[model samples]
Target: MMSLNQVCPYCDITKINKDIVSVDHLLPKASFPVLSIFPDNLIVVCKACNEVIKGETIYLPIAHPCYEEVSRHFTFVIKENNNNKFTIEIATNSKNSKLINQKIYNFIKLFKIIDRYEKYMTAELQDYRTAVRTPNKCVFIELGQLTLLPPNLLLKRLFHSKFQPCFSY
Candidate 1:
């Protein structure tokens, strides 16, 4: 399981809170029974994405977001004609091109992550636009300065502020 502070390794969202909808099998447990209980094979996911994307058998060769190096397998494409709609497209250089394509197709159908997350992402993007237009005071101070904090100081502060006493130590 990922730490609470860690974002969804798949969707790369850090805003996930206690309402953590479900556990995602990083390597679809149905296909890889041996890895079912593996720690790295599980991740926390928002209810919306989890409920929509799991529990199906499609003979696609796409790597799990957590298990496979997604950067090399897919790229996010914002369609120019679809009101900037975003979709993940398979990389042409992917070793198992056919399987990857199939996986991508099936994964989208299974998860319905496109339309669901698209609405959320669109709202988020709008928020970002608003932020850019009128920056928030708190965010402005922390934006580029996060890297300037000392490593120990950052760790201590993050743990102390974000976690319970057990994690704080």
Candidate 2:
């Protein structure tokens, strides 16, 4: 997670505490029983992206957003309407075009990410504002070094983002 910067590649539009963090078998264990413990077949994702959205579902032969780097295949468009509500859409500027767009579209729709992200856009923006307005600039880097955490998580701890430790272990 630290390597991925602690953000679930799928739908980490909101802050994720450890309890909801889970391991996803890129190839579902139910389908490929042999790959259940295969390190290469695993991807760590938040509970929502794992259980709630993709449980036992397979999107293989497409992009897994990890080794495949979905961001390279697509970008996001954050649109703000007159009502100040934000909407996120997958961009159509993929160098590979059609198939990539469709894959990302399917992933987003599967997770209802536009709606989920819209629900927390304000809070995310608020956190960003707070970070920009913080009196200490060096502290973020300092904290990251001290905790060995990634930038996004450093921001979460520094700004006290909406997270409660839900992990039992």
Candidate 3:
């Protein structure tokens, strides 16, 4: 039962387009027919995540967004490649809890978070590069302002054009 104003739990994308927001079955109806109508089985997620988690094929234990406070267990690590490209990885910090570790792993793999994030980062870098090269464009990112936002909201701002530009004529 997530609101559109919130980020998608799976991918951490801000739902800017209402058309892409959808009610996804946490456990696909095709596989869990009995739980199809179960209230807990339904979650609000962006269409991209729905497409990625198409159905019952994801049998590995994933953290239930409603029941599990799993965010603290995982962290995103981004590494820069030699060619100025970047790759992303999700590292689990729950060393004491094997089950939590497994759920984090399964969630990352099932959602292809690493791959998708890398793709997004690459595209974002390209956009930034373009913005930087455009003449008379005054762009500045206020890292200090981002500190006030939650992790997901900070990411949403970073990924979008939330960084305001300062101009001096």
Over 1-169, each residue of candidate 2 has an lDDT whose tens digit, in order, gives: 3444366867655345577677888787888999999887787778888888778876534566666565455444555567755565655453676777777666667667667755655465445444544564322232114123432353355344543323223
Model 3: which ten-residue window has the lowest total lDDT?
142-151
Q: Rate the local accuracy (lDDT) of all candidates.
A: 0.49, 0.59, 0.66
- Pairs with backbone N, CA or C atoms under 3 Å apart (clashes), candidate 3: none
Top candidate by TM-score: 3
What is candidate 2's CA lDDT for residue 110? Answer: 66
CA deviation > 4 Å runs, candidate 1: 26-35, 38-40, 52-59, 80-96, 123-169
Each model's total of backbone clashes: 0, 0, 0
Error of 2 at 113 (Å): 2.5
| Model 2 misplacement above 4 A | 1-5, 14-18, 123-169
Model 2, global lDDT? 0.59
Give the range of the ten consecutive residues with the poorest summed lDDT in model 1: 160-169
**Candidate 1: clashing pairs of residues:** none
**Highest lDDT: which candidate?**
3
lDDT per residue (tens digit) for residues 16-122 in model 3: 35777777788888878998888888887787788645445564688776787656676666555688676665666646388878877777777777777677666
Relative to the true structure, candidate 1 reaches a TM of: 0.48
